[model samples]
Target: MLRRNLPSLFRFSSSASASKPVNEEKSRSVGRKAVSTALFCLTGGVALSALDDLAIYHGCSSKAMEKASKNQEVVHAIGEPVVKGPWYSASLAVAHKRKSVSCTFPISGPQGSGVLRLKAVRSGDDSWSTFFQSRDFQILILDAVLYVPGNEETQRNVKINIADNIPSPSSQACTRCPETRSPGKQ
Candidate 1:
């Protein structure tokens, strides 16, 4: 019995003092701390990048669109506002040689949104350009016009209506317009 238990005793004794030398243990601990810190920083950077992308996706909100429409120049220049990824687009109509003409708005989104960055760049001798940049930081150009109804200020700013033109008929005038006859007269 004594011989059999001797091996068990040795195993117990080896397990009892597993601590390494003081200096070696301290160095290992410091290395682990460094690794932990680096991992934390990397994770934080990734999270911030994701938040920026999300903020850019929302684009311009209802209020900004209203304000732009109120001003005659902005209204006339206002082209299509696009909702693609992290960019919303609108154009500005400004006189040539104007130092600067642009409208910027704030973006609201899933986490920590930011102000939109708008700018007008000279496209050609005859053309002026405008763009809207999202928080995720991308630029888009205007291609179509968004229409709204009612002249009232209350209704003007509100996006109650949006006009989406139908695609050109396969053949010219192929589709019929709605009947104009009065309900009872018809």
Candidate 2:
């Protein structure tokens, strides 16, 4: 009888080793799940960043364009073709004319703001030239569409008001309120 019971005990120990095989398979499955979860997180992070850039561009484009359009007379009167560089650049010597300057506000991404410089050339007898460099890295994509008032050699009697900087998700508006002024020029 003792021998019969001993064989049964050995059988129980053998069944325990059978579980080792299933344990190995479960470990592998867990590893696979972890890898896939990590991949999903990385892809989601990239997509979110792209969406942020698109939002910023769209929100700022229209407002900036409107402001620049209002200053079109100045651009037509004083702006000279910015030759020798990209079409985006325009040199303008806005003397006594309204001028709206758009600056690339840095998004504070890893690549900081790329190089941006605008120049201006005055028109007249022995006209001079100057570079708009006060806020070198503050201007982004700028378009100076000229809208000249009829029959004017140059527009010198309009008000030049640069639109306020559009704050980003990471930035805040002015701490103190700017002095209020009457809406468009009277």
Model 2, 44-94: lDDT tens per residue?
888854553334333343344444434433334434321122223322222
**Alpha-carbon lDDT of model 2:** 0.40
Clashing pairs in 2: 92-120, 103-138, 103-139, 103-140, 104-138, 104-139, 104-140
* Cα displacement (Å) at residue 7, model 1: 16
For candidate 2, the per-residue lDDT at 59 reads 34
Q: Quote the positional error of residue 151 for candidate 1 in Å.
A: 40
lDDT of each: 0.40, 0.40
- What number of backbone clashes does candidate 1 have, counting pairs of residues 3 or more apart or in separate chains? 1
The candidate maximizing TM-score is 2
TM-scores for every predicted model: 0.29, 0.34
Give candidate 2 misplaced runs (Cα > 4 Å): 1-21, 73-161, 164-186
